[model samples]
Target chain A: MIRIDQLIKRYGALMAINGIDLHVPAGELFAYLGPNGAGKTTTIRILTGLTKLSSGRAALNGHDIEKETLAAKRQCGLVPQNINLDSELTVSENLDIHGRLFCMKPVARKAKINELLTYVDLHERSKSLVKQLSGGMKRRVMVARALMHSPRILFLDEPTVGLDPNIRRRIWSLIKKIQQDGTTIFLTTHYIEEAEFLADRVAFLDKGRIVAMDSPIKLIAGLGNWAIDWLTDDGMQTAYFPSRTAARESATAKENGFTLRRVNLEDAFLSLTGKKVQ
Target chain B: MMHGIIAVYLREMLILKRRLKRQLSGMAISPLLYLIAFGYAMGDAVQFNGHTYLEFLIPGLVAMGSMTQSFSIASDINVARFYWCIFEEFQAAPISNFAYVTGEVLSGMTRALLAIIVILALGLPFGVVLYYGPLFWLAAILNSFVFASLAVALAMLVKSHADQSLLTNFVITPMAFLGGTFFPVDRLPMWAQKILFLLPLTHASKAIRAVALSEIPDWRAYLVLPVTGVLIFIFALRSVKHARD
Candidate 1:
């Protein structure tokens, strides 16, 4: 569980997170969607105790991030946006260090390392140095490393960035499994489809503000069930219709050829903020 | 807090253990060259304080080696911060700033001790035996603490690896050469001696060299090392906090 109230983060003259409020109940998979520099990462950073908040209050499972930093940090595991696993260390060694940092007992640490390595399907590669692993393998190791201490909440910041679609799907399944195992997941990602497929609830953030927040299906439904996309002199344009027949009718009315497709989470985001998730 | 310190230290020790062979060779090369080039070349031709030049140079080399090797932890910290992003991982963890600083400072001191051991072993082939009493080790540890703490502080402040290198060139290199390591600070001009005396390594060199020669060292040198070490350690803690912010 996490709670944030009127959270404001300012870097000199620029606002990184502007007066946002959020509460994620335990065991929910929450996706934060935004384009580059849209404050998604900033919020995650603030929650995980990596960066201090400029103003307002944030708590992790009832521990204040500022006052009870260690306790708050102990409640959450963060898979950072960057590939930060120690390259010179083995995959298991990376997880071992994380376990140690959280003060896990040696026996518990070893067992958990083995369990998580297996969970991520990298048990055979545990002895391999992180640098020797492929990108997908490294990402899996990061996931396993983050889960070593078995924190109740997980913060995944762009966990599948730069991975191939197949690998991304694998990571998505892993994330789904993590949520099913009763861990609350707070995710920030640029992939709209990722949010749609994995997130129980989605928040679209833009320019340091949340423009909309709801279930992905509900957000899409609110924007209508079908969409007609056409290329115009001005650029690509899209219109949404409640029914496929209405969408087809709208497509036929177009001056040029058009495309008819189901309205997706990205369309909901674009309809609200007039910007691509990215 | 203790657990946090042990965990951080354990990570460093694991890495050090993995690269022990490379690190040992690196530790030996510089001291060996100094001993052969300066010790054999001078070879009792120069004497100071009723000792052969080789004898005098060994302790000086120990002092300098401790300073350089201890301060070298900064490069490792910079590599972790800039390349591996390991420091960020530590920041995200539950470790307190004090625990992180203590763990890193201890690792740096360990490296300094290992380097000092290599230098002493290298001195044995030349048949230069000296007292390595508790006082001598105290001075060595205190010296390492001062430089290692300074290293952590500067590593946090530097924006990039190049900036860290610039710091070494400007700060550690000059101290290594002029801090009574190669020759007596007293032999220098009065003004130069006064400036070098301000350096913690100069006091460390004086204290360590005196202990090795079985002489009562100036108490002020012992006092200066820990006082400076504690101050720099506190600064390192603040730097870590500032970095987190």
Candidate 2:
């Protein structure tokens, strides 16, 4: 549903996104994993038409973002990294305005707002001011507001960055539900577990370049089935093994105070970039 | 585009509805104080264009009130951009830049009109009355348009709330006093009149005061306002686009 070719974004002497390319098919959940300032947000902003590209061609469901901005924008809904609902407006009013911006009819807009509020389980707070909502409740409202227009693709940029673990899981389920309903989702995050649990195809971005891209199982399997960690004079060191028995055999607690565990997506990123996801 | 502009305008109206009491009180207090302090002090002593001081002050108040109230939209824009981050909501939506600008400018104009109504209503009990014809409305709307458009441009250019306040203190407050709202430009020294003549509000006051007194206003004043309004509106559009970059 989204296609980007040779995207290059520059800020004077610095290039934010340096010649990256991606394609997310319809109904696929694509996770873009990166550390801070790794061009993840900039890529999303370019795809959503909020930032202009220095040199690239991006299309949303066949509509060029630069040449056909309104059509391209209409194809996707965005939940930004921050909560941006109007504080004084009621929950319903916030959804109502989004509907209006998309030119939904009044009758249809009301119906859609009602449906989304219920979908996100915010129906009880429909009339409450956004400022009165808790952090989790506010995040749910943002989700509902983004879905008001029923766009084909949803771009969630760090949708659960600062939320509690429980709230983050709730949002994870909501994202899953959105994908199950046949809408393509492009999610960006620095949380390794979020990408591992949610994304169908994950891409690792470091310094404005894609270093790795594959399914969670494939990426982890390529590295190893288990990992052993121990502290050294330089820092922490980890070794990957193909089997649990092999991993246990490699970790000698008496020598270096080692620990053995299953390999995860973070190990893949660490192996490729030589840096932690955090 | 029209629907998107109306959507934005309706949102502003909803906010206006919620704060109606506070806004009405605010709009009422200042103009009433100006009338009481200036009117009773120079009731019979001053004669402007052969009318009593209160009569002359009422229309000038209308001009000044409209300018200030209309330009006050900058505060709202700043709050949206800085605190709420609501501009990103519009940016991600399918709304056009022109639609957003037109919507905000019209909302500002509506606020100015409401302030004009309050001043006019306040004028009645004091027995201060004047003629309000089509020309009067034309002048009022054009005056509101000029300031509202300028407010949008300045709102986009400023970085912080402190910067916004600095703009109000240095630009808007100075224009309010010297724009022929409190005294006639002709009454100022020749050098001051020459500088004040360059102010768009000066032409607005000249045209509004003339029409309020039932005189045929200088056509040049009418021409200057709409032309200036269009130019500023264009500038506001460009400013908004640049801000997005």
Candidate 3:
């Protein structure tokens, strides 16, 4: 569904996205994870044809975004981070105008707006002015706005930020449903758990570089902690470890018993980046 | 291109409509307030070519409205586009470069023309003659579009809303006032009037004043519309195309 090769973006002497190569297969939920200023947003902008890539190639279904931009963009929907919307316009009108932009016929446009509103659970609020709605409602409306054209792929840049946990979970569920309906979702998020739970494949970007790319479980198990936690009867129990060979022969093994448990993404993240998760 | 252009334009108008109570009031009243202050108050004191001061000032005010209102389009859009980030949504969509630029200019022109009409309507009772009514209106539309196109060109080159605001106040207002809108260019020295004629607003004001005063107007008035329109259109297209990848 997406291909990026040796993409490089530079501002004067600073590199925003450097030599990044990526492939997102059709119908896959791909999560792009990166720290702040890691060029994830820049990459998203470039792919959407909003910003120019300094050098390299990006194609959507083999249509180059730079050459056949309109056709390329027609294949993708982008939900931006800032929740850009027409606050004065009613929900229906906003969707209506966006649908019109896609050259959808009036009758079809009305039906599509209804379908999208229902898909986003915003049918009841369609008559209300966008400003009158809550923040989470506005975000959902934006999601519906992106889906108006029914693009084969959806790109969300930080879909959940500044929203409460409940809203975040709701959005996550909706995203899962979208993927199930066979739309490819490419998202960039700061929330590691979001990537962990939703992404079929995760790409870790740090400082304009992709450091790690793998499945969550394999990523965690590959870099093991093998932890066991228990409340000892005496409460002063110690833990033991083996480096190699019959390390149990050490006196530490005889002195204490430790439980073993599987390591998770946080462990792998810490191991790979050496930065503790907040 | 047309669909996307009009979609964004209609979308912007919808936003304005949502804030209708405020948008309608703000745009409608500012010109009337000017008419009352400059028209009624000074109509008794000022005289130009021996006409009522209100009548003389009304045309200038109309011209001023066109130029200043054009800036308002760019200014408000700059706020929504850069500060509020509404423009990025258009960027991320399938909207073409021409459509995006045209949509923006159209929104500005629409608002500017509406303001001018409201001002004209409000002045109808105050001996605001519409001699050559259609001609005057046609000229006003042409001039409004010219200023709007110029504004879009400037807006494309701007980096921030604050910078655009500073330039608008410093550049747009002075050009409107000195473009022979306030008084006749004949009042200026020979060299100064010649300099003023070089400005598109001068011809714009001439067209308005000629129609308002029931005069025939100079040939320059006829040329200003199409020439200025083409120049601004060409320059704006080049700017937008250069910025587009």
Candidate 4:
């Protein structure tokens, strides 16, 4: 569980994370969605105690991050935006070092490493150096490293930025499995589809502020708008939606050949941010 | 508190073998060349504190090696921020500040030791006298540990790679040279002695050189080691703590 209240972060004259509140309940797959420079990473950095908060309070499982950093940090595993791993070390060695950071016993760490390597399908590469691996392999290794400590809460900042689509999908499925295992999952992504497919609830952050927060379906429904489309010899004509019902009613009154569809995250994102979701 | 430090220590020693080999060629070998040319070529002129010039220079070279080594290991902290891509791992881990600082100190000590051995081995027959054998090595390690902590603290104080390198060139290099690696501190002007007293490398070289030369070993040199060690350790600890949380 996590609670963030009125968090304010400033850099010179610019406010990075303006006064904002956020809550994540146990066993939830929560997605933090924002574009570049939307303060998503800053918020997660504060939670992990890697960066100092300018003001306000953040708690992890009832322990304030600033005051009880060790306790808070012990319960969380962070997979940074970039693969933050030791390239020179073997897969098992990577997990070993991470486990030791939390003071995990050698015997316990060995077992954890094996279990994680297997879970991420990297057991065969246990003795291989990270630099010898491909991009997808490295991502899996990073995931395995995070799970080595058996953290109760996992914060993944763009865990699938440049991976192949197959690997990204595999990662999402693994994330779902992790949530099913009862670890609270907090993630940030620029990919709307990722948030939609994996997130139980997604918070859309724009310019350091959360403009909307809800499940994907609910968020799209909240948009209350829809688009009707007709493919002609030239191109597809897409209509705007402030009302799905109205859009549907219009579809009934259209040129009699248009396809009417329910509004989805892509549509909702465009409606909310005034730009097509990339 | 020391577990994280041990993890870092192990990682550096085991995974950085290639880098160590490279550094031995660069920092260790470059100075050993001086020991070679000067030890045999200029056998006539270089003497200090009552010993052959080569004898005086070899131990001094050992001290110099340790100082540069300890300082270079400190540079890895900055490297972690830039390329190794693992700085955030340490930053986010729940380890005590003591562990990180200790790891840096130990790595620096290791590098210093590496450089010292190679330089000593290369300068063996040139008449560089090493009097205290095992104890000399012990003092060398301790001296390096203290200097390493000081170097790491200062390295962390800077931000970018260029800035860190400039500091190493301008600050660490000057400290190594003026701290009496090539000459006795007594020979310097009395005013400069005041400044040398303020630098850890001065005491480090004094302590290490005393042992390498096998003299009775100055009690002043012995007293300076632990005091300077604790001071630098505290400064490093505070800086890491402030940076982390």
TM-score preference between candidates 2 and 3, better one: 2
Q: Ranking under TM-score, best-scoring first?
A: 1, 2, 4, 3
lDDT of 4 by residue, B1-245 (tens): 77898888887886668466677688766676777676667786765756776777776777778878887876777777666658789877888778888887888888888788788777766545467577677667767877788877876677678888898888778986788777789887889999898876777677777777766566776677778888888998887766553
**Which of the CAPRI classes, incorrect, acceptable, medium or high, describes model 2?**
high
Clash-forming residue pairs, model 1: none
DockQ of every model listed? 0.81, 0.81, 0.61, 0.57
* Docking quality category of candidate 1 according to DockQ thresholds: high
lDDT of 1 by residue, A1-278 (tens): 89999999999999999999999999999999999999999999999988889999999999999999999999999999999988888998899889989999999999998899889999999899888999999988988888888889999999999999999999999999999999999999999889999999999999999999999999999888999999999999999999999999778978889999999989988888888889
lDDT top scorer: 1
lDDT of 3 by residue, A1-278 (tens): 99999999998899999899999999999988877888988999999988899999999988898899988988898899997887777899988887877777898899999998999999999999888999899989998988888889899999998899999999999999999999999999888788889999888887788888888877775654353334556663322233322233332354356444445565566667866433
Ranking by lDDT: 1, 2, 4, 3
Candidate 4 chain A: minimum summed lDDT over ten consecutive residues — where? A269-278
Q: Which stretches of candidate 4 lie over 4 Å from their true place?
A: A224-262, A273-278, B18-20, B125-129
Worst 10 residues of 2 chain A by lDDT: A247-256
Candidate 1, B1-245: lDDT as tens digits: 98889988888898999899999999999989989998888887888978998888888889999998999999999999988888989999998999999999999999999999999999999999899999999999999999999999999999999999999999988998999888989988999989998999899999999999999999998899999999999999999999886
Chain B TM-score per candidate, please.
0.99, 0.98, 0.90, 0.90
- The fnat scores of all predictions, in order, read 0.83, 0.76, 0.76, 0.71
lDDT of 4 at B35: 70
Pairs clashing within candidate 3:
A227-A261, A228-A259
